[model samples]
Target chain A: MALSAVRAPKIQLRQVRKVFDAHEQGMVALQNVDLDVSANEFVTLVGASGCGKSTLLRIIGGLEYATRGDVLIDGHGVLGPGSDRAMVFQHYSLYPWLRVMENIKFSRRLQANRGELTSSEVEAASGRADALLNVMGLSNAADKYPNQLSGGMQQRVAIARALLPRPQVLLMDEPFGALDAQTREVMHDLILHVFKLERATIVFVTHDVEEAIYLGQRVVLMAPRPGRIDTIYRVPLPAQRHQDMKHAPEFLALKREILQRIRETSGMKTDLELLEKLSHSVSISSLRTQG
Target chain B: MHNFSFSRPARRPAWFAVRGQIGRREYWMLALVGLVVPLLLWWSLSASGLVTKVFMPGPADVWNRAVLWFREDDLLGDIGISVYRVVAAWGLSALIAIPLGLAIGTYRPVQALLEPLTDFIRYMPAVAFIPLVMLWIGITEGSKIAIIWIGTFFQMVLMVAEDVRRVPMAQIETAQTMGARRSEIVSLVLLPAAKPAILDTLRVTMGWAWTYLVVAELVAANSGLGYAILRAQRFLQTDKIFAGIIIIGLIGLLLDQLFRALHRKAFPWLYLR
Candidate 1:
């Protein structure tokens, strides 16, 4: 059995503190947050809104700069937005102007443009893009623009684009948050399939505890009010996850326990308020759909 | 968690339905109504003789004058001259405006330095510049072209800047995350992303170019449609004045339609939703 527990840490965050300057005072988005993720490990950060889970993910992705402390990738100080880390936002951040195949190709070309490729390399890259599209079940819609795609399809293309350069770390902020229940189920299976296919470290942030436990080998529970990790739970599920496993008594037991822990970690009033604010920030349709 | 519904019921009236999309048939019918209603009003007023022909020429009188202008006089020559001047001046304005607007929009320091000045200048009507332009350029074709350019350039700059600002921040960040250099981001992401709206800005400002043409040819010109209108006004050739007005409207409509068609062809994906 290949276990990630014994592996060396691929990503190390040392006392990361982020304080956003408000008008008169500062808001602490993360307070001395420290986390270490091993290579090929799938870690999911679960919490109610405003727990700074997304902020933590963004810091790791280099989309944001932390006010204090260091983020190190492979024992090196993190630089801003390199090709080594790729992100999939909750909002389908696919380029609206580019077609699916072109979007994947463009992001890949930008990252991997170490001078012109030989014709064979170009052929291989095209083959990989096509294979990714097939895995995402978007082969038929390759020529369509992002605007023409459904929400699930758009997110799939976004994930494909993020995967094009074969990034070492994949940061996803609720990648399937906007999808319907059926689509989300399919996406979960698709994501699990992709996880099995590749051996990259993934950090996923979501509000759903069940999803966190389902997708991750280790689930990190976060709490708001100066956001910090409350606890990290090692999943006891089988090495290979299945849809049927969600209904298993062990899975349900873990899901219920995590739900109770999350509920108590952040009190109801703040959680409800955060949910309201988040719903208003994004479309209500995304929040209304149960995932 | 199950206590409340996510969506609230709309309080819209039963008769007032809202929808984002309209069918092609309905669109054409609405367009037909737009043209037909105005023509109906003109036909009714003219046929009823509510106003005298001298004061308000009927469609027939205007039509007769139009035929005479195109067939007998140097009307086509005047039309050609006005078109050429507008195309030249407007083209020159775009040449300067697009790049300058891009720089102003992309960098806040550039905007801070120039936006206030442009904001002040654009408010001053292009018509107010006629005397000064005539003084500087001495009533040459340069003076006429200067009229359209001055009237359009500043306003276009502000509009292009605004459209540039409206480019999605998410798109830019995405491009950056994809390892695009700053210059590459500007060229591949920002410029192409801002294109459709900039084209729209150009379309809107070109209409202003037409309005300023009358003021442009005010600089002692003996040839444009504006000059013809002025000459007709002096002789009290009311029909010729009306005919010139009709010509301006027709030409403006033609130019607007051509721009719209070209825009559609260029950015088909932009119109999907």
Candidate 2:
């Protein structure tokens, strides 16, 4: 558990492919997807709706099995779902029957048998739940249920619940997609704050390009039609970045490039003038030309 | 620069205005009217002699009979016995049904094996099995309890099974990702998620169990409010009959309220809406 000893990628997916035959018509979700996510890295997977980014995240979270290839954590092949990985899904996956405080301590409570929960264990779990409630700014909602909260508040609780377990790798599938525009902005900052404080490896899946670039140290832009990683762009912002950085020349240029790549992958004509502006400013290449 | 303009706003009738949900205060207000109207109608008809005394007793006659039964006729004893039988039978049914339902609902092969048998038994009347139950266990207390068991067990099993099946798959998967074992999923995830609906199923089935109480009493030699009512019917004591009917209705209402209150207190998060 020492920080210095954890050097390699926290999670690795090699030659992973997923196909669905449960339906009458079979469909390929992902093909030949290879990704190496380093420790404490905030890597965002951005793509079109059918790009299988969620499927890739699910494979790592052990919710779905890859049809072919390997999913490894710290270099060991995953046999089934494990506690090392925690996932926050798009549908506000907090347990509806549990209160905010109880939801955050779900993992700890489950780890210990219910009737036999020791006093010391209860004290420790409660302490962690209290700290997380403050961190997520949900102290007032400690006793409230998920259904009683707003969509944004519910997602925050979900994030806190996932983080409570201190999972080695946190996998989120479009955690903020259901929020309103203003709430989404607040969540972006909250996620970055939690990421800095916890310093855990995170792989966030989203379809919003600007959000991917805004939060990710490395934005993995994926493409559809057998869902492959088309390119990866390293965000060139400083460590102490603010929302205003989104308007900077560097940020906009990278965003414009990724947007163009997305449009091209989806089989739409790329505007030549937009491409000229994107190419002029960036030093790091899209660097992922498919064979 | 921006310019401002004013125009008359359109209005709609009050009846077309829809509110989010009816508040508890408003609900109780309507319930008051609902209670008074039925009783007032009965009182007016009986007092005005629209129905003959031989057919229907006035409220006073029924009330006096109720007092006499409570004072002299062991009415409380009979009511207590009937309630005990229903409780024992329903409790037994729940004990067997909850676990069996969870199993049948979760595992496909278990469901396939038991569901057809359960479906067939529910439609067969419990009264039809009275003779068979007498042959097996004799026309003792066991037969009465058996009649109630036949009346409620299969339906309860099927209902609880449906409730367990309706628990979301995503919650179960989430529990697994949190390192929950196969058995842990049932205790922590499936049971808690289905708590509200399971309580509801028990509440509904309890009323059905009450409906079969008289049939269960019919098989026995003596005792219970149902036996008392049947004895009064043979003597043509319609006033006594009305008293028994009123007591049964009041008991059913009391039990329904108890379950409803328990539901509200146990799962306020669900009832808040």
Candidate 3:
């Protein structure tokens, strides 16, 4: 058998642009975005609040359409949401009426409703859901409601629900943003384990530089104000990562460089100066009140 | 260990404190106070002779009249007919309005077509439709039911729609990204997500349905509590009128409590505490 030269990208975006209210003074949420995700790549997008990173991910997921350019998944032009991609939102997004196991079963029901899975396949999906529940350490919470669990536990259920389908591409929009620092650290390791176990290409979006560096094989830095990708940095760490690697010199150096680039791109320096001025005035006003 | 004890444990932190929680015992005690104070006030004012018995009936007189009415008249039948009318009309309204509301809330075109029409008709007053309902259905049980339906249907449709609309958009998008078809999105995502709120709307609209009872029985009806109240008013049977009013209030309260219990039973997740 002849070997192929170049492996086709699992997900590809070429010259993508998104303009809200295009007929009027349009807001360009994303501009000229081009990227390729390999078969099992883990990519993290980091940016300020309005940097269009979330919008770009939504476009790729077919939750939103780009105004121009093409998004190709497995060389097919993207249309609407399909079974090949599953999204994990920062908000837990579990149906409150459904129990944890039922929530995981929902994706399978969707597939069954589409006639994509036969009866035996549907039964297999439930077994897979049980396996995922155990993997996420939520077997005890299988009968509990979403509101009965803590935020971290609910997010874990969401991750398990998304992974149950075994979609080729997993799109996560800051799944740990609402978690506390300690829980975020725990989730970082949990997600890395799942990524390795599932072997699915992940395009994760986050605002935390440390989180992006800790998780991504390549970090895509984005900028706001007509939101575009600014830089891409390859992590120089081994395939397997430890939590203590966050303090290594190479990690710190790359973190500092990306942090600086984000600040410059988002105009954080001028905003910081304005913030200092406001603090000085606030202190003076407080002293006057005390006097 | 230092023996530092205080008397009464800081006075139980002020019974009427803002947002303070009371135990079940205290809650029942306060609830009794709410009922007893009004009863005592009514008894005293009537006994003082400030108003004639023709105008105001004492509690004992009303209670005796209620007993007499129950034995001498078909009081239970009246209560049954009134309950049946409200329940039948409201059940019909729910059967129609819930689906219409779900459609309106789920689809933009349906909302555009129906919401304004519902808003406009809800203000027309169910009582005002009495003449037309009488002319159309002609002084029968159907007209009475129609009166209540006209009263509650529009308001219920809008409330149910709002409840469906309140289901978070995130839940719908989550379903979409999982490749759920439109029908699946409605049945699996929108319906289940909005169910508790829809049930709440049903409970509330059921109360509004009872408020139209008198207007419904006004259409030449001889049975039901509303007709009985009107008949007692003509003969200056003030005690019987008071009896009718109290029975209606009790029935309304009973229905409301039943709804509350049903809500708690159906959606245990919402009542974690």
Candidate 4:
């Protein structure tokens, strides 16, 4: 953090605010959000649904503009989505018509269409896509269509496609939110491995607290109802991480603290609290007698 | 088998159960029944003499007339001409509509300009345009093709546009974040994503074109199946009329099957088990 103060942060969000005019009142999706992601940093935004974490990420990706404030990358204001950033959405983002290998090379096709790539560059991009396919453990499924692959494999292909452009920033919105527990763990590790290898800054969004803590170097907790950042916690663990670290004391403490804070911020009643309220209103025996 | 069962729910029969699917063998059996039952009903009704044969010819009489038409008359030529008119007009409409639909669906400006006009034009029935088509293109093969075009083109453009628009927002947004331009998004993202659906739209509109065939051939045409049917109607050649109508129905069914086969071949991903 001290070093980033001297060197400019890779990305800067200064008082970013977004108001969606979907309702008559003009719903405030995000407000007063300021964040700095250092080069190669992995930041995760965690909150309940409607917290504007995803919307914030979209703003950074230039998919949506902030209703107020600035989004800067390398200290330059974002005009629109550029080649400098790539995003992997939760699911169904891969072009179903393109095969795995072809999907991975899709970015290059976009560049070629703009007359930005030479024939040699195109060939090199193809070779690099094959390498990415291997990295994602998707070499065997290279020739298959996305619909033919499992949800996990399709996400891997999406990640491979996003990484091909080698953008400075990678934004992911609950990339594993749809997977089973085991598959989610596998994806967590795979993404971290890719993050380290690619040396690109990542901003991940998830409602999964464990995911936010495990994958993020710093966890930014957000709150709903005119969404805004509540707190940012720096992970106390070492740089190199493993699955076992998730169960470590510091990790558990952070997780518990964040979970409690999220409940408070979102004003959601816990299961115990909800049950207590219900029991006070009516007893199980009363319903049994009626039955 | 522990005998823990109390009351067992009745199993749903495959044919009528909600969302139930049958194997290929069962499907073929059901399909054969579907076809034969309709034919049998028609035959039994005609044989019962509930309706005069002049209006509803017996299956045997129609079959004999069809055989005679094929062997003795220029039925082959008529079939060939009719098929050519539908294919040519529909093909022409497709060549324009597919791209125009893609444009209208992809760009708001294109949609604003073309969609309302196309919608308005489509509601004006193709049959109603016979007088205008005759006046504009004159009483020739061109007018027949024009009539078919008038029938199919406007509706096709709107359907194609709808197909393109139905492509998920995520696909386009993913492309955008990957540095795809507006035009690139259409060609690279929307076009390929909508291809399977666009093909489906084409298949449905091809059916529409066939429905318009008789309307199209109602103009100063003298060679096609529609022409043969009309001439048979004028002379009260009821059996020959039955033959013509049956032949057209068979041809339309064949075309529909060909489209399905093509869709399966071209978009194998859509049919993944």
Candidate 5:
């Protein structure tokens, strides 16, 4: 299969830029971003809100287009959404009206309609869905609606739905940002397990730096105000890293280093400093008037 | 481990927990108050003889007429006819509205083309169309069904379209990323996400369909409950008219109850609140 041997970077984004005309505000979501993910690489983009981490992931997923630059999936110029990629959204965007099993079967039916597979092949895909449900520990809730499941379980279903098509690249946008602390930990473990099992190149976007450190092979930290990558750190830990690794001295040092870089580029002091200077000038003006 | 013993006597069930009772005590009490207050006022008016029975019939007279209608099966037949019309009209409307609604909802071009026409039709009263429909389809079952369908179809389209549009953008994006075609997106994401809303619209439009029955039967038709009421009105038979009104009220109540039951059965999680 020469198609399999082409050795394409599973996804590549070259000098991507995104601009949003939101409520009369000219917001540059991403700027001059160049990134690539190899096959089975676990990449994470983490930043403050409006940093365009999610925008960049959406571009790679073909959900949104960049104003400049190009997105390529396996050497093909990304046009629109393609089956080579699958995305899981933050709010557990499972169809509430469908049972878990039906939701999983949806992508398979789509594949069948595309003439990519026969009826029996589609049935095998459905069988894979059953197997995925079992793997995700949602076999009992297979018949239940999205509303009936807890936040964690719903996200599990969302992940399962994304994996149903066996996409080469998985794009996730803060998929666990809604869960509580304990559930988030469990979901992190579950995601790591599935990522290993599926061997799909994944680009996960989140605001949680600790989550990026724990999950990503490379943590790409982004900065806002014309969003661009601030730093990209290749995690030196072994592939089978655990939660306890977060407590290690080396891990803490890396975390502190990344945190320092984030704070430097954060531009957090501009607004407050401007306000203080303005207040001082205003007081001086009042004093001069009194004098 | 320490063991503590503090046992209390078993308590009786709360008011709502009782089973196999015809009605709750509060319901009976409310019913009593309702009956007695109205009866006392009516009896007082009747006893004063401020109005004669010939002109203003007493409650007893109306009750007797109701009993007579019930005994003669006229009330039941009227109720049956009204139910038949509402169900048939709504069924036909659903058959036409849902597919068309889905189409218009899924395709922007179709939606833009049909939106103004739908908006114009929605504001036009079903009753206002009675004369025109009578002329076009004549005073027959066809005209009545057509009027009811017209009354319901516009509202159904609007509701289903709104539901379809309300399908989350993220879901559609997710499906598209997984390589779903436009038609597949409609079936898998748009339709399923819009299911509860569409069902709710169908249920609501059932009531609207019933509301059109009187106008639909305004022609030379002779059998429906609406026609029966019209005949009663022409002859000044107020008692039969009142009976017909009561039958309509009861049937509407039953239809609403049926809708609620169906909603709960189909969408049990939606009723968790």
Candidate 6:
């Protein structure tokens, strides 16, 4: 009985490395990443551009392969994309030809094809889809095409589509990046509310420090060019959060900590000076060897 | 944020309500110019006696001959035969070309294998293929349809294949992530996404079908519009020849309009270029 007492993490990544051959440049995207996401926990990855947070999320989603390590979902080796994991892309990649209801029901139909569910089971799934549409405040626009909706409404539909499969892990790569600031804030709140309601484990990647602090249970900061975990902060906040909490002491402290870590890892100071020197210099190849 | 302002509604003019319902002003002006300038020039040339009336008949003479042909002979039958050839050849071309194009488009090895042959056939003038078609299926309706098919099929194949191939990789990946099988991806995602492009190619290829019809009927026994023109040419009836030419232009324009209407009905999503 004791041997059967163990519970696996929803997602686990160990010693993962990813490399790309960008023609002449040998690009190292991620190196030796070790992470564990508990069931129903919300985690966020934050860094500047090129820090490979999105790449890491893709590896977890089984959309990309790691050159050197292991990615396991519920104790099984992640090989290809599965219904157990769903991703929300930044570009709102809903099929233009399909209406909002059909987009939401797509994954469910695929799951039905795998013999995981019967016709009656699919009918139940459709009911749940209707409920999700209501939760996302898109019940009125269920018959509209993606192009007919606003950017915020489109993203809401994208979220609904991702949640339809009822995946154990929801991987979002800056899902609100295209929305305006006011809409982004609203979407962030909506997402947190949905997470609490569904109790689904989420791995969200973003470059905004405040957003990471606002939405993450644990914020993981990554360094660039061979991206690795720079720091992890456990956010102390109530389960139900509001805009007022963002002005609280705890929120500001976490924001400052994340911003400082990002500054340290960004290489901005040295890069700026080098860029300034390059702009002024006519020929820098000879000057490089002496330096 | 800026404050919102409110204004009183202005009284509408009667002409303002009817503005969009009427034909565009520029189109009417162009039509007037088109009619007057051509007629005036024709009358001036005829009165001036620059060219003889036997070789280049006036528009009035052509119109009179068109009326006579309609009244005396079965001109409608000729129109019907030409329409049949166009529809049959185009329908057959769609059946053969769309699937073949999809196959070549989706599979890299197939594309590579077929690309050389595709390019060769696409560039080789369709008129050049008429002699071989005549030799193979000589002077029959089969040969005429074959010529039209040969002319349109290659262009359809290239256009449809390129359209299918150009489907966004992101869309495919999205489908894959949803656990769609290979066939499901092709049918549900690839086919629907390529529908607009395929319809566009079909519209363009319809015009090519009409062009091939003229060449196909040139060698034939005696039926379609092309044969009527050929019969007129034998007697040197300049008015009859002009009438046939006008009918061909009008039919081509009508077919183009029909395709335009179908395009609007089928794919209202695609913005017209």
Candidate with maximal DockQ: 4
Q: List, residue by residue over B172-200, the lDDT tens digit for candidate 4.
A: 99999988888889888899899999999
lDDT by residue for model 2 (B139-186), tens: 888788889989999999999999989887767877778888888988
How high is the CA lDDT of each candidate model?
Answer: 0.86, 0.87, 0.91, 0.91, 0.83, 0.84
DockQ of each candidate relative to the true complex: 0.47, 0.37, 0.69, 0.72, 0.47, 0.32
Pick the TM-score winner.
3
Q: What is candidate 1's lDDT per residue for B1-273, written digit by digit as tens?
A: 133554876433333346555667978898999998987788688889888777777778888998998898888999999998888888999999999999899999999999999999999988888899888888789999999999999999999999888887767766767777888777888788889899989988888888888888878898999889888888888889988988998898899999899889988877785
Tens-digit lDDT track for model 4 on A104-214? Answer: 988998888789999999989988998899999998999999999999999999999999999999999999999999999999999999988999999999999999999
> In candidate 5, which residue pairs get closer than 3 Å at backbone N, Cα or C atoms, i.e. clash?
none
In candidate 5, position A225 carries an lDDT of 89
Per-residue error for B188 in candidate 4, Å, reads 1.6
List TM-score per model, in order.
0.87, 0.83, 0.93, 0.91, 0.81, 0.83
Off by over 4 Å in 5: A1-8, A20-27, A112-127, A253-266, A270-291, B1-60, B70-77, B234-236, B267-273
Off by over 4 Å in 4: A1-6, A22-24, A118-120, A269-291, B1-17
Model 3 chain B lowest lDDT segment of ten: B1-10
Instruction: Tell me the TM-score of model 6.
Output: 0.83
Model 2, DockQ value?
0.37
Q: Is candidate 1 or candidate 2 better by TM-score?
A: 1
Per-residue lDDT of candidate 5, residues B81-159 (tens digit): 7678778889988888888888888889989998779999999988888888889988777888988988998988887
How do the residues B50-96 of candidate 6 rate in per-residue lDDT, one tens digit apiece? 88978888888888898888888788888899889888999999998
lDDT of 2 at A122: 78
lDDT for each residue of candidate 3 in B40-159, tens digit (9 for 90 to 100): 999999999999999999999999999998998989999999999999999999999999999999999999999999999999989999999988999889999999999999999999
Kindly list the per-residue Cα lDDT of model 1 for residues A123-240, writing each as its tens digit: 8889999999999999999999989988999889988988887888999989898899998988888888898887889999988888899899999998888898888999999868
User: What pairs collide in candidate 4?
Assistant: none
- Scored against the true structure, residue A263 in model 3 reaches a CA lDDT of 78
Give the true-contact fraction for every prediction, in order. Answer: 0.47, 0.51, 0.74, 0.82, 0.74, 0.39
lDDT score, candidate 4? 0.91
